[model samples]
Target chain A: MAVQVTQAGADTKTGVSGWSLSIAPRRGALSVVEVIVLAACIAAALTMTNRHGVDIMIRTFLWAGLALAWNIAGGYVGLISFGHAAFFGIGAYTSTILLLSYGISPGIGLFGGALLAAAAGALLTVVCARLRGPFFILSTLAAGEVTRIAALNWRSLTGGAEGLEIPAISSATDMVFATQWPYVGLVLSYMLLVFALSVWIERSRYGYYLFATRDNEDGASAIGINPGVMRVSAMALSAALTAIGGTLFVQYFLYLDPTHIISPDISFEFALICAIGGLGTASGPVFGALIIVPASELLRGWLSQSASGLYLVLYGLVVILVILYFPSGISGAIARGWAALTKKKTS
Target chain B: MGGADKKEDQLMLWVEGVSRQFNALWAVRDVSFSIEAGEIVGIIGPNGAGKSTLFNLIAAAIRPTSGDIRFLDHTITRAKPYQVSRLGLARTFQIPKPFRQLSVRENVMLSALRRHRTPHRANRLAGETMEFVGIDHLADTSVASLTVGLLKKLEVARALATEPSLLLLDEVMAGLTPPEVREMMAAIAALPSRGVTVLWVEHVMMAIMNVAQRLLVLHRGQLITQGKPAEVSKDPAVIAAYLGEKYAARS
Candidate 1:
C-alpha cells in the first residue's frame, strides 16, 4: 500500500503537479490549466457572431459558477442539497428590488443579494444540519418550495409572478456592460473567482472538518470539531457564491421572474452537474460544466422551440444513466481507470 | 492515601453519584469513581453490566441523570462530547469505527489534523502513530480492506493522534487472537511512558491483568471491587459478582 501511494505520488508530481506550477503556484497546476482553458474558450467565443456567442459565454460562465458553488456544500460536505434555487431566486429578487425600488447601484444590489442568500443558507443549515439521508433532501426541497411560493405571492417586493425587468443601466455604476465581450469578461472573471474560492475552501481546515463530518459525524465531534458549525459555514459560503451567479444572471438576461429563477429544474441541474462530474473533487465542477452546458445547449437547439419537454426527458435519462453506471460520477470513474492503468504498467 | 500524596495524585477525573433512569429501570445508579493522573485502570464486567455506560458518562457521550464529573479542576457534568474531547481526552468505541472511505493513514490524519492545523505536520504525525500501532504497513490501504485486528489498531492510532493526556479504550481486544492480544497489551502498557493515561474496558482477563495497575469490577451498575489485580481477583464480592461456584470449584 505504501509503495502504491509512493508511485501515485510520483506520478501526480510529474503530471498534475507540473500542471499546478504553470497556473497559480499556490493553487498548483490546476489553476494554470483553468486559465489556459478559459483563454481557449474566449478565443472560441470570439470566432462566433458577436452577440449570440457572447450571450452563450456569459450564461455558460454563470452556470459554471453555480455548479462550483453547489459542489462545495453538496459535494464536499456530502449534504446533497436539492434546493439551491432558493438562494438563486433570493439573489435575483434582492438585486432587482434594491436596484428598481431603492435606486441602489446594481453592484451594491449584487453584494446585498449575496449576503441575503448567505444568511438564508445559514438559517436553513441550523434547521437541517442534523437531518441526513433522504430527510435532509426533503427538508431542503420543502424550503425551496416555500421560497418559490413566497416569491410568487410577494407582489410588493418581487412584482409577483409577472416578474420585473431592469431598465437600461444608463450608467457605469449599474455593472451593466455596453457589449457582449464586456459581459463575457465580467462573467468569466466572476467564474474564476468562485472557482478559486472553492479550491481554497476545499484545502482549508474547515474543508477537512466538512469532509470528516460527512465521513463520520460522531468521530468528527469526538475530536472536538463542531460538525454543525462547519456544515453551516460551508452552506453559507456556497449560497453566497451562488447568489453572485444569480445576480449576474439577472443582469445578463435583464429580467427576474420567480418561476424562472426559483424553478426546481435549476436546482436539479446543479445536482446533476455535481453527480455527473464527480462530487467532492476539485476539478469535478469544471468537468461537469464542460459536458452539461454544451449538451444542454445542443439539446435545446435540436428540440427547436417545439419540444422543450424532450430536452427535460433527455436530461432525466442522462442523470439516471450517470447514476446507474458511475455512481461516483465521471471524475471518480476516471480516477479508477487511471489507477488500474498505473497498476497494469507497474505489474 | 496521605494528604500530601493525595494532593500530588489529585484526581484527574471524579464521577460522583451519577445515575440514569429509563422510566422505572435504572441503567446506572449512583456509580462513582475517581481516577488520578498516569493511572491504567481496568473496567471489567459481564455483558449488560453497564460498564460501557460508565465509560460513556466519563467521555460525555451521554449525560447522567444526576451527578457531576470534574476533569482537570472543572465540572464537566453537562459538557458535550466534543467539548469533553477538546479538554485533552480521547476514546475508542467498543466496536472499531474506522472511517470507511478514508485510508488508514488518512483516518489517523483526520484526528491529527484537528490537533495540528498544518497538513504536513499532521501527515507526519499520523505516519508515526500508525507505525507505533504496528499498522504502518496498511497506511495507504483504504480502511474498508483492513482486518478486524488491524481496524482496532487503527482506532487506537486515531485516538493517539489527538495527542491526548487521557485515553479511554473499550473492548479493544474483543476479537483478537492470543498473539494479537499480547501485541496490543504491550502497545497499551507502553502508552504511559509517552505520557498518556489509559482507562481500558476489556473482557480479555489475561490482557487486562497484564497491563492494568488496578482492576475495577463493575456489577449491576455499581463498582463491585477495585484493588491490585491479585487482591481484587480474590475478593468475595468480585467472586460472587463474576465467578460464583465456578471460582470455588477451580480453587
Candidate 2:
C-alpha cells in the first residue's frame, strides 16, 4: 500500500525528498501551472467568445461558477446535498420577482436573492445536521421538492408556475446588454470570481478545518472543530454562489419557470460538472464545465435533426466512463499525470 | 458535585454515571471515572468492551443514553464535538486514520490551527508537535506512504498539535514492533511534563503496564478494576475476565 503511493501519485518535485500535491495549501502560493490555467481562461474568453458559440460559452462559464460553489458543501464539507436547485430557484425568483413587482433592478435583486438563498441553505443545513449519508442527500432532495411545490402554488409571487418573462425593454441599469460577448464577459467574471473564492478557501485556516472535518468528523470534533457550524456555513456559502449563477441565468434567458429552474436535473448538472472535473480542487469545476458544456452543446447542435435523446445518451456514456474509471475526475488524473512526468524527468 | 466539577484543581475530566445503549444492547453501562490534571490512566478490556464508545461519549461524537460528562467545568454530554475540543481535549483513533492525500504536516496543522490562526504559527506548532512525537522529518511526506509505526506517531502528533489539556489515546501501541512500541512508550511517558493528562486505551498489556501510573479494567461495559497496575493485574475478577488464572499467577 505504501509503495503504491510513492510509485503513482505526487504533485510537485517527487524525487528523494518526497511528493506533495499542488492542490495543497502551500501557504497560498500560486504555482506555475495555476497562473497558466487562469491566463488561458482569460485568453479563451477574449478571443474565442463570439456570436455563434456564445450561449454555450456563457452557460458553461456560469455552470463552472455554480459547480465551484457546490463543491464547498458537496466535496469539502461533505454534505452531499442533491437539492441545490432550490437555491438556484431562490436566486432566480428573488431577482425576477423584485424586478417585475417593485421595479427594483436585477442588480440589487442579485444580492437580495443571494442573501435569501444563503438563509435557505442555513436552514437546510440545520435540518440535515443529524442526518448522515443517503438520509442527508434525501433531506436536501425533499427540501427542493418543498421549494418547487411552494413556488408552484404561490401564484401572485411566482406567476402560478407558468413562469414570468422579463419585459423586452433593454437598459444598462436593468443588467440588459446588446451582445452575447457582454453576457460571456459577465459569466466569465463570475467563473473567475468563484475560482478565486475557492482558492481563498483552500488557503484559509477555515479550509483546513473543513478538510479535517470531512475526512474524519470524529477526529476533527475531538480536537475542537465544529462539524455543525462548518456544514452550515459551507452550505450558505455554496448557496450564495449558486444563487448568483441563477440570477445571471435568468438575466440571459429573460424567462423563468418553477419546473426548469428548480428541477432535480439542474441540481445534478451543477454537482456532476464538479464531480467530472474534480470534486475537491478549485480547478475541477472549471475543467468539468469547459469540457461538459461545449461537448453537450456541440453534440446537441450537430445531432439536432438526427434524434432528440441521442446527444444526451452519448454525453451520459462519457460521464459514466469518467466516473467508473477515473473516480477523481479529469483534474485529479491531470495532477497524477503531472506527478508521474516530474518523477520520470528526475529519474 | 457541580461545585467540584468546576474546581480548577479537582480533575481535568469527570464522567458521572455515563451509559450508552445501542438498539437493545448496553454497549457501555453505568461507567464513571475522573482523572486529574497530569496523570496517565489506562483503560483495558476484552474486545467489545466499549472502550472506544466511552471515548466517543467523552468527545461528544455520540450522546450518552443517560448521564453527565464534564471537561474543564463544561457539561459535554450534549455538547458538540468541536466544543469539547475547544475546551482543550483531544484523542486518537484505535485504527489510525491519516488523511491519505494530505502531507503529514498538513494533518497536524489542522489541529494546530485551532488556536493559531495564521499558517506560519500553525506550521511552526505542527513542526514542534511532530518533533515532540519524533516524526518531524516526515512532516512533508504524504500520509499515504507512512508505515504503521510512523502512522501511529503521526496520529499522536495530530492529537498533540491541538495542545489539549486532556488527551485520550486509543491503541497507540497496537500492531507495533517491540522497538517501535518502546519508542512510543517513551513519548507517552513524556507527555505529562508538557502539561497533558492522558486516558490511554490499549490492548497491548506490557506497554500500558510499563507506562501507566494507574489502570482501569472494564468487562462488558463496566469498569471491573481500578488501582495501580500491579494490584489490578492480581485481581481475581480481572484475571477471570481477561488474563487467564495461570498468566495471573505468573504475573
Candidate 3:
C-alpha cells in the first residue's frame, strides 16, 4: 500500500496534497539495486568477449522483453494465456515470410508481424471473453497448438516443417548482424521499451481500469469500466509487444522453425519468467529474465553432454519452489523486505 | 401521464413491471416504482424478498424477464452494466466488494477515472469522495485491513466517486455496530443534498425509517406496500409478512 507520487516533476497537474499515484515506490535501496542490475546487463552486453556468453546475454534480454509483454495480459489483466506462442510464431513467421518472399526488410516487416499478432490476440480475447480461470487458459493453449499445427501443414505459406532461414549475409536493413553486440543492443532496447510501457500502463487511468477489472469485474463494470474492452485491449497490446520480441528473436537466430517458434515450452518460459520475477510489476519479468535465462543457459552448458535434460529438471524444481514459497515472486519479496526494514527503523 | 410536457421534471428512475426469473423460480415479479430527483427511497424486505435482485436488474447486472427500466431518460433494461453505470447510475453490492489488492484510495480512484479520465484529476476527486464518506484517513491503507463497516464505507466512497445522479445502495449498514450505523446513516442522509437520488435496500429498519423520504416494502418478489415509513410500518400486510406484530404495536 505504499504509494509514491510519480517523480516530483513528472506531472504539474497532480496537485492533491496527500493523494499518491498508487504506484509502489522501490523505497530507498530497491531503486539503487535495480539501477545496478540494469547497468550490469548493459556492461555484460557491451564488454563480454566470449561468443557463448554474449549469446546467453542476448537470450536473457529477449526473454525478459517477451516476459514483460506477457505480463500485461497475465499479470495486469489476469488473462493467464498459454497461447502467447501463437502471437510470437505469427510475428516471427510474418517478418521472415515478408523478407524471404517479398524481399522486404525485417525492420519494416516487424510492424506487419506485430499488427497481425495484435489482431490475433484481440480475436482470442473476444472469442474467449466468457471463459474465466482454467477454461480461458485452456483455450489459449488450444489456440497455440492450432497455430503450431497450421504452420506445420501449411507448406505454401509457412514453408512447412522445413522452417525458414534468413541467409547470413549480415545486412543492416535485413537485421542480419555480423557481431552479436548489435543484437544484444537491439534486444536490450526492446526490453527497455516494454518495461517503459508496463510502467506507463501501471500509472495511467487505463491502467487503473484494467486493474479494477482484474481485481473485481462486477465492481468495475458497476463503475463504468468495461471489463471486456479492457481484457481485449490488454491482450492485444501484450501480443503486439511479444510479437516484436519474436521478430527480434528470429532476426538474431536467423531461423524460424514452427516446432521451436510456437512451442508451448517457449510460452511457458515467458510465463515462468514473469512468475519468477514478479507477475504484474514492470521490473519483475526483467529480473526474472536476467536471473533465470543466464542460470539456465549456464546449467545447460555445463550439463550438456553428461546429462542433457538434467538442467530442465533443476529448472522445474526452482520454478516450483519459487511459486510455492514466494507466490508474489522476487519483486514482491523485495518490496516486503523493504517494508520490514523501514518499519524496524521507524519503530 | 403527460411525461413529455415536463421533461426537466422527469423521474430519476422508473421501473415498470420488471420481473426476473432464475431457473424455475421468480426472484422478482411484476415490480413497479418511480423515484423523483433528489429523493431518498428505501426498499425493505425479509430474506429472499428480491431486493438485491431488483438492484441488479436496475443496474443492468442482470436483465429483466419482462419489463423495462429507465434511468433519467434512458432505457437500461437491455443495457450492459458499464453502459448503465456510465449513464449516471451506480450500485453497490449487498456484501461489500472492495478490490482486495488495492488501497482504499485506489478503489475510489477507479470510479473517479470514469469522469476525470486522468489519474491526476481522478486522484483529486477520489480524495474528496473518500473524505466525504469519512474514510480519507484510511486512504492509503489496504482494503484487506478494513473491517466490515469500513469496507461498506469504502463501497460508498467508490460509488460516490463515479459522481452518479442516482445511487443504488444495498445493505450499507447490515453488519455495523450501533454507532457505525449512525455514522453511515448521517453520511447517506447527506447524499440527497448533493443531488443524488438514492434507492437503498436494507434490513436495518431503524436506519432506513429515520432517513428514507419514502419506503417500498416487498414480500415474495412483489411490492406489498409503498408509502411513508410510518404508514408502511402500520400496514397490515407489511406487518404480517415482515415486521412482527410486537414491532407493529411498538411503532
Candidate 4:
C-alpha cells in the first residue's frame, strides 16, 4: 500500500517570500550574448588591417583562452593555482625542442607538450591532495618557482637565460607564417576551440561534479564524488589546455625563455583576467581578456613616450578597484543585472 | 539480542569495539552494536556523548582509533567516505552541508548521480526525491535562501536520492517546528517499507520515541542500554544518565 503523507511546507508552495535569490543565473551553451561576442571577435580578427591592431587582437584571444583554461581548476574545482606558467613553459619548450631537434611540426608537437604538462599537473595535484586554501596556493607558487629555476639552470636543452627563437620559415605545415593574418586566424581558432570546450564542459554532468566539489568537499564526498579524483582530473585538463596556449604563444612570438615564459607574472595574468571577467562562467574569461588586454596594450602604446610606466600603475589601479567594488567580477555583475531586468519586465 | 549468532550478511550494520580518542578524551570507547536489516535504531545521548563521532566512524568520515565497522559483511573501517558511501551507505551532516553555489535541485542531483550515471536521469531522480520530500517548488531556488526546516529536508532528500540500503541521519530534526517534526517522522517511519535500515542520532525525545523501533541510550562515550523504546525509556540507569527523573516520571 502507498503511504500517503502530507508535506510540511504545503503553504510554502507559492515559494519563499520577498527574497530575490538569483545572484548569477545559470547560462546554457551558446547563449545569444555569447554568440554575438564570438561573431564580433571573429569579425575584428578578420577585417583588421593594421599590424599593431592585429597584434593586440592576437594577444587578446590568446589571453582569453589561457584564462578559460585556468578557470577549470581555479574556478570550477577551487584549486587557485599560481603556478600555471610552469605548464606554459613546458608546452613552449616541448614544441620548440621537438621542432628544433627532430624536424617535427609544431602542429604535432603541441599535443606532446599538452600531454607532458597534463602529467605534471596530475603529479602536483596528487602530491598536494592533503593541503587546502593558502597551503595549496603556496605549494603551486613554489612549484612554479622550482620549475623556473630548473629551466634556468639546465642550459643544455632550454638555451639558458637567452632563449630559443623559431626560424622565420613561412610554412603552413610547420605553423610558421610570413604574414600576421595567418597568425590572427590561428590564435582565433585556438580561442574558439577553448570556448567550445568550455561550453561543453559547463553543460555536462562532469561540470556538476566540479561545482559540487568546489562548494563543499565533505558534502560532495558524502554523495560518492571523490574530491581528490575530481581535483586531479580538473588540474590535468586545465594544465593541458594552458600548455596549448603556451605553445601558441611561442608560435606567435617565435621566442621564449625561462624568465619570460615561466614568470610568476604570466601565471598571475591568467588568473587576474579570469578574476576581472568572472571566474567560473564560460564567458567570463572572454570578457576579461577583451576588456583588460586591449586596455593594457593601448595604455602602454599611447602613454609609453609621455610617462614611462604610468600605464602599469593605471592598470594596477583598475584591477584593484574592480576586485574591490565587484567581488563577483564583471561577468557576475552583468548576469545579475540581466536577471533583474528580465524579472522586472515580467513582473 | 542474539544478533551475534546471525550471519554477517543478515545485519545491515555491525560496529565492533569502536573507539575514537582526541587527545586525552575518548569520544567513543569500545562500543559494539549491530542493526539487522529493516531496523530503525535511535541513538540518544546528551551533548558531547560521542554520538556524532560514532556516526562519523561508521561512515568513514574519520578513522577509528581502534575497531571494525562492517556493512553487509564488507569491512569499511579504513574506507574513505566516498568508498563507504558508494557501498550503499548514505549519511547526512549534523549541520546541513548543502552545496551553496548550486540550486536545491542540483544539490539533490549530485547524490542522485550515484545511482543514475547521467545528469539527465539524475535530475529526474532528484525531482522525484524533492517531490517526495515536498521541496519540488524550490527546485531552482538557491540553497542560501532556504529556511532551516527546508535545508534539513533537502539534506534528507539528497541522501534518499542515492537509493541506499542503509541511511545515517544526524540531528535532522533539531530545529524543526512541531508540525514539521511530525511530517519528518512520518517520512522517516515509511523508510522500512522501501528497504532502508535507518540509524538515527536524535535529541528530540518525543519524536524519536514514537518513531524508532528500538533505542540505544549513550552516556559519555559508552552504551548505557539498548532495548525496545518502552523498556529503554523506563530504565533507571537511562533516566539518571540522560533523561533525568523529571522527564522519566512524566513519561
Candidate 5:
C-alpha cells in the first residue's frame, strides 16, 4: 500500500517541486587535493622538458599557460567565454607590432600587449555583463570576429593578412633567445603567474562570491555581492593572463598571423580544455591540457598529419559525453570516485 | 491600544502611506505601520492581502510607488536590499533558499563574509551562528541534504550571520509541527536578548501569539488593528478577519 501511494505521488504534479528538491553532496576535498597534484605535475613537466627535446617541452608549457589563463574566468567565474582568442590576438599583435615596426623590445611589448588586452576585456565585459547565458557567449564571439576583421584590414599595423615577422633580438634583454632555454623560462614564468593568480582567486572572498554568483546570481546579490563587477573583474584578469600567454607564444614562434591568433578554433580549444578537466575546479584546465594536448599530438602523429579538424571533432564528442554522463568532467569524476572509495573504506 | 507613548517612543520602522501599484490596481495601497525596536510584530492577512508585498517594501526588495520608510532613523525607501542588510537589517524568504551547492558551513560563511570582510572572522561568526541556530551538528552537511525544518533553521542561521539588528522572517513557521513551532518560537524569542529585533509574518496564529510582543492585523493591505497580543486577539476586527463575519456577527 505504501509503495503504491509513493508511486502515485511520484506520478502526480503535486510532487514536482519535491522531486526537484533532490539534494547531492558537494565536492570539497577534490579542490585541495587537485591543487597539490597539479603542483607535482608542474614540477614533473619542467623536469621532463629538461630530459626530452625542447620543442615538445616548450609547446606543452605554452598550452598549459593558455589553459590556466582561460580557466580563471571560464572555470572559476562560470563565464564560459569563447572570445579569449581576441585577447590572445591583441597581445600577439601588440607585441609583434611593437617589436617589428617601432623597434620596441619584445619585453616591453609583452606588458604593453597585456595591458591593452586587459583594457579591451574590461570594456567588453562592461558592455556584455548584463547578458546572461548564450547571449553573453554570442556577444563575445561577435567581438572576437570584429577584432579579427580589424587585424586583417589594418595593413600598416598588422601587416594585413600576411602577418608580422619578429626579427631575432641580438641582446638578451630583448627577450629573443638564440636557444630553447629562453622559451622554457618564459613559459614557466607565465605558468607560475597563472598558478599564483588562480591560487589567490580561489582563496579570496571575491572567489567565493564568483562561485556563488555562478551558482545563483540572485542569492549572491542578496548576500551583498554585485555579480556584474565580480564577473567583469574576473574577465579582465583572465584577459591579462591570456595576453601574457599570447606574448610568450609570439616570442617562442617569432611570428604572428592574425588568422592563427584570432581563430575560433583556439577559443573552442580553451573551452574544451576547461570542460575536459573540470569546469569549476582550479586544477581542471591544467589536467585538461595535459591529457588533450598529448592525445591530440599523438593522434596527429599516428593518423594523417593534416587531420587537424579531427582533434576538434574528438573534443566535441568528449564535450557531449562529459555533459551527458559526467557533467563534472574528468577531474570531477575522479573526485567522485575518490569520495566513493573513502566512503566504502570508512563504512 | 495605539497609545501616545507607544506611538511616539517605540516606532523603529515607519512606513507612511506606502502603495505599490501594478498597472491599474494597487496591490498594497496607502498602508501605514510603525514597528518598535526589540518587538516581534506579526503581519497576518489572507493570500494577496499584500502582506509579502509590504515586507518587500520594508526590506527594499521593491520600492514603494509612493511613500517613505524610515528604518533606524534613516530613510531607506529607495535603498537596495543589500544596503538594507548592511544597515543591520536581514530577511528570510517564504521558501528557504539555501545555497544548494555549498555546505551548511559554506552557506552561512557566505553571509558572514558579506557582513565581515576577513575570512577568519567570517568563519568564526559562521561557527557561532550555526551553533546558535542548533544546526552545528549539520554544519558539514550539504544544504541539499537538509530537511525542510533544518533548512528553515539554516535560513535563520544565514540571516543571523549578518548580525542583523532587525530581522524580517516571512512565514518561517508555516510548515513546522507544533513542537517544532514552539522550539522555533523559543529560538526567536531569545533573539532580542542578543540585541536583535524581529518582525515575523506567520499564518500559525498560536506561534504568532506566543512569539510576538505586539500584533498588527492587516486586511487587504490596510492595518486593521495594532495592540497587545491579548487585546488585538480579542478585537472585533481581528476576530472577524480570522473567523469570518458569522462569528463576528454572533459575538
Candidate 6:
C-alpha cells in the first residue's frame, strides 16, 4: 500500500530516539562496512578512474546521487513519483539552453534550472495532494508525459525534437573538460553533495518529520505536522536535487534531447534504483546504484551481440527477486545479515 | 458527577450547536456542551450515535456542517487538524494510528517534537509522558509488534507527549482486559493533575464512569441529555436509549 512496506531503510541506525539516546552507544548514520564502502567509492573515484574505465565509475556516482534524490520522496516520504525525468529534463534544458544561446555561464544556469525544476515538482505534488497509491503514481506519469510532449513541441526554445549540443570548449570556467577525469571529479562531488544532504536530513528534525509524514500521515498531523506542507516541501527539495543531477548529465554528455533526457524511462530508473538498493534508508540508494549501474552496463556490453533486450530481462528478474524476497532492498538485507552476525558473536 | 472538585473551572472548551452531516444524515446533530479546565468529561453512546464523529469534529479532523467550537478563545470550527493540535488541543484515535515503522519512543517523540524543538528535549518529554502512562519499558520496541494493551498505552502516550491543555480520547479501553482497563483508567485519572482537561469517548462504561467528572450521552446523532454521571445514569431517556430495561430494572 505504501512504499517500502517491508523493511526499506527503516532499520535505520539513526534510531536517535528511544532509550538508545540516553544509555546506548550512539550509532552514526553510517556503520563500519558502510563507511568502508563509502571510502572505497572515494578511493575508486580518485585512482580507478583511469584503470577501471572512467565511463563506468562516473555513471555509478551519478546514478547513486540520482537514486538518493529519488529515495527522499519515494522512500522517506512515501511519494512514489515516476516523473523525475521531468525535473531532470527541466534542469538539462534550462542550463544547456542558457549557456549555448545566451552566452551565460553554466554555473548560474545550474541554480536557475534547479529552482525551476523545484517549482514544477512542488506544483505537481501539491496538485496531486489528495491522491495516494497507484493514483498518485498515475498522476505523476501523466505529468511526465505532458512535460515530454511540451518539450518535444516547443521547438523555438528547446531546439525541438532534433536536440541541442554544447560547445566543446575546454575551459575550467565553462564547466567543460578535455579529459574524462574532471567529469568524474564533477560527478563525484555531486554525488557526495547529495549523500551529505541525505545524511543531514536523516539526522535532523526534518528527517524525523519526513519519516513520520510518510509512515503515518494522521499520526504525524496529531503532533502538528502539516502533511500537505511537508509533502510539498519534500517534493521541491527532492526535485531540486534531481535537477542538479540533470545538469551534471548535460555537462558530461554535452548534448540534450527530449527522447533521452525527458523520457519516462529515466524517471523509472531513478525510482527503481532506490527500490532495489533499499527504500527509505540512506545507504540503500548508494548500494543500489553502485551494484546495478555497473552490473547492467556490463551485462548489456556482453549480451548485446547474442540477444537483444536479454540484459534488461535479466535485470527485471533481479529486481523482481529483490522486491519479493529481499523487499527492503540490498542494503536492508545486508543490515539484517550484519545484525545476525553481531548477535551471534555477542551471544 | 456534579460532585466535582469545582475549583479549576475555567471553561476550556465550548461547542455551540455543532452538527456534522455526511450527505443528508447528521452524524452529529446540534450537539452543544462546555468543558471546564481540569475537568474530565466522558461521552457515551450506542453504535452510530456519533460519539467518535463528535471527537472528530472537536479535533478538527472533519469540519462540522454547522456551529462553532472554541478552545479557550480560539474559534476552531474550521481549523485544520494540525493547526488545532498546535493550539494545545490533541486527540487519540479509536483505533490507534501508531507509526508502525517507528520505535515506541519515536512514536511519542513525533508529538513531543512539536513542543520541544530539540530531539533531546523531545526525547525527554516522550520519556516523561511514557512514564505517566506506564509504558517506559516498551520505549525501544517497534510499534508494529506492540500488543493491544501496550498499543493503547502508546496511543495515549503519543497524545500526552504533545503536551496539550485539552485531550480527546476515543475508545481507549476497548479490547483491553480488566487489568489493562484498570491501568488505563489510572493513567487517565492522572491527566487532570497535569493540568490537562479531557473529553473521552468510550463504550467501556466502567472505565469512563470512574474517570469523568460529568457525562454526556448521545442517541441517534443528538444529545439526549448530559449531567453528573450519577444523575444522567438514572435519567429515564438515557436508561431507555442506552443502559436499557435490564439495567433499569436492577437499578
**Where does candidate 2 clash, by residue pair?**
none
Tell me which of candidates 5 and 6 scores higher on DockQ.
6
Q: Give the range of the ten consecutive residues with the poorest summed lDDT in model 6 chain B.
A: B1-10
lDDT of 1 by residue, A1-347 (tens): 22111111111211211223433212112545456666776676667675654566667777877888998888777778889999998888888888888888778898898899999999998987678999999898889989999989988888899999988654567766666766777777887787777666655666667777877888888877888888898899889888888888888778988888998889988888878877766666766777888788778888978877798789779889988887767655665666677779999
Q: Which residue pairs in model 6 clash with each other? A: A9-A281, B1-B213
Where is the poorest 10-residue window by lDDT in model 6 chain A? A19-28
Q: Which residue pairs collide, candidate 5?
A: none
Candidates in order, TM-scores: namely 0.91, 0.89, 0.93, 0.93, 0.88, 0.94
What ordering of candidates by DockQ runs from best to worst? 6, 3, 4, 2, 1, 5
RMSD of 5: 6.8
User: Which 10-residue span in candidate 3 chain B carries the lowest summed lDDT?
Assistant: B1-10
Please tell me how candidate 6 rates in CAPRI terms: medium
Q: Where does candidate 3 clash, by residue pair?
A: none
> How much lDDT does candidate 1 score?
0.78
Native A-B contacts reproduced, model 3: 0.55
Model 2, position B21, has a per-residue lDDT of: 98
Summarize candidate 6's per-residue lDDT along A76-174 as a digit string, tens digits.
788999999999999989988888888677888889889999999999998998999999999999999999999999999998789999988897777
Candidate 5 lDDT, A1-347, residue by residue in tens = 01111110010111101112111112222244555655665576556654334566667667777888888788777788889999999888887788777778878898898899989999998998689889999988998888999999998788879988877765576678887776777786776668667755655677777777776676666666777888888888889888878888888787887798898888888888877877765556767777787777666665666775686577567678876776666766665666667779999
Better of 2 and 6 by lDDT: 6
Angstrom error at residue A159, model 2: 1.6
Best candidate according to DockQ = 6
lDDT of 6 at A219: 87
DockQ of each: 0.36, 0.41, 0.46, 0.42, 0.23, 0.50
Which parts of model 3 have CA positions greater than 4 angstroms off? A1-30, B1-3, B243-251
User: Across residues A161-227, which tens digit of lDDT does each residue of candidate 4 receive?
Assistant: 9989999888887799889888888788888998888866766668778978998899999989999
